[model samples]
Target: MKEDTPPPSSPPPLPVFKMPRVHKQEYWSFVRLVAPSTEMPPGQTAWKTTDAELAYCLKCKTTFKYRSGSSASIRKHMNHEHPHELGSVGREAAVKRMKNALASKRKSSAVIFSPTKRTKKINPAEEEMATRALIEWIAKCLRPLSIVEDEELRFFITLVQTMHGIYELPSRRTITERMQAHAQQLRSLLKEKNAEEVDFYSLTTDMWTSRTTDSYIALTIHFMTDFFELRSYTLEVASFCGKHTEVRIRRKLRDLMYTWG
Candidate 1:
C-alpha cells in the first residue's frame, strides 16, 4: 500500500466562554410624595381643603397641621386615629387634588438629579430626638405647627434632617401615639418594680382645671426604700370627667386603684 494516510489530526478544542458577573447596587427605596398622576381618582377632590395647610380632622372636628399641606397628612391622621375611615371616602382623592395643584412646578422637563446608590440610612437616635422635639413643641411649648410647614421649627429640623439623613420627621399623629405609648411603657415598668423596692407607699391625690376647662387629677405616692432613701413619685395623671363629688371621687379613686392593682 502506498504511504499511509496522514495521521489523523485532533479536532480543535471547543472554546469556553465565561459568564460576566453582575454587581447589583442597592438604593434606599421609599415611596416619594411626588405630584400625583395627571388626574384625581373619584371622591378625592374634597380632601383639598386646608387651613394654613392643616387638614381638618373629622373625628376631632378640628384643623390639625401637617408638614406638606398634602393629602398624605390627612390620610396619615385618618390611618392612626380613624382606622375605620380609610378606603371609604379615602384621602387619595384629596391628595390627588393637591398634587395636581403642584404639578406645574414638578415638571418632567425640569432638571432631574440622578439617584445615587450610596444613600444615607436614617439615624434612630436623631429620629427619637426629633420625636422629643415634636412633643416639646406641642405639649411643652403649645405650638401646633405642622412638622413640614413650620418656618422656625423647620430651620432646626432641617439642620438635623440634613446632617443625620433623616428626611422624614415625626408625624403629628406619630407624636400623639408615641407619647401615649411611652407613658404606658413607663407605667408598666413602675408597676412591675415599685412593690419590690418599697414595703409601703402613701398616696396624695388632687384635681384641678386649667383655663381651658380641661380637668386633670393627679396622684402621687411617697415611700421609703429598703435603703431608707425617701422617694416621692407620681402614680397617675388622669382626666376627671363629669361632676366632682365625694361619692364620684371615691369611686374614681377606687377605679384607678383597680387599674394599677
Candidate 2:
C-alpha cells in the first residue's frame, strides 16, 4: 500500500503588525515602531544627537526618524504625504494640541504669552524715559550692568509690563557710553559750582591693593560752598602699577590738579 504522504502543510501565518502605544500627543496610531538594528543597513550604526527611534508608516510603510519620546516627525510625514488620511478636522486638532503643548512648556519655563490680547503701543518718549530710569537705577545702586540681560528680570517685565514687546534693554556698550555722558555732565556742573562758590579746597588721597593684587589710588576733593554747605567729590582713581612712592603720589596729584584746571 505505498507510502502515504502526509497532508500538505499550510504556509506560516503572516506577521501581525502591532501599532505602538505612546503618549496621546505623539499620535502613534498612524505608525509602527521599528527596531533600530533592522531599520539601519547592515554594518552601519544609527547615529543621532538625541535618543532616536524609528517610525514606520502603517499606510505607506515609509520610515521616518524622530526623538524617542516625540513623534513630531512622524506627524509631519503624515501631514505631508498622507493628508487625505489625516482629514482637515484631524489636522486642525493636531495643530491645536501642538500649540497648547508648546504653550504649556513655555509656561513651565516661566515664560508667559498672550495671543489674543492687544498690547498698548509704547511711544518713543516713554521708551527713552524708561531706559534712562533703568540706567540711573543701575548706576546709583552699583548693580551689575549685566542685570539688563537677566532672564528672570525679562520674564518679570514681560509678565507685568505691557511695553515689554516694544521696549528693548540697553546693551552693555550703550550703558557704558551713557554712564560716561552722565559723568561728564556731573563734572561740568561741579566745575561751574566750584568756580562760582568756593574760596579754598582741601584734598585727600588713599591707596590700596585689591584681592587680585592690583593697586589703586583715589583722590577726593573737599570744599565749603558760599552757603557753608560742605561737599566732596572723588576726582580720580588711577591704577598704579609701580611702588607707591611719596614723589610718585605728589606727581600724580599735581598732574590731576593741572588736568582739572
C-alpha lDDT score of every prediction, in listed order: 0.56, 0.66
Runs in model 2 lying further than 4 Å from the true structure: 1-167
Record all residue pairs in model 1 with backbone atoms less than 3 Å apart, i.e. clashing. Answer: 44-93, 44-94, 67-148
Task: Report each candidate's C-alpha RMSD, comma-separated, in the order given.
Answer: 25.5, 26.1
Instruction: Candidate 2: give the clashing pairs.
Output: none
lDDT of candidate model 1 versus the reference: 0.56
- Scored against the true structure, residue 221 in model 2 reaches a CA lDDT of 88
Estimated TM-score for each candidate = 0.38, 0.37
**What residue runs in model 1 are displaced by over 4 Å at the alpha carbon?**
1-163, 166-168
Task: Give the best candidate by TM-score.
Answer: 1
Query: How do the residues 1-261 of candidate 2 rate in per-residue lDDT, one tens digit apiece?
Result: 897643323211222233444445335556655553425555756533232355566666566565765667877887788764465336557767755665564565463447554334589999999899999999999999999999778755654442325667789999899999877766666676667677799989898999999998888889987788889999878788788888988888788777677
Candidate 2 matches the true fold with a TM-score of: 0.37
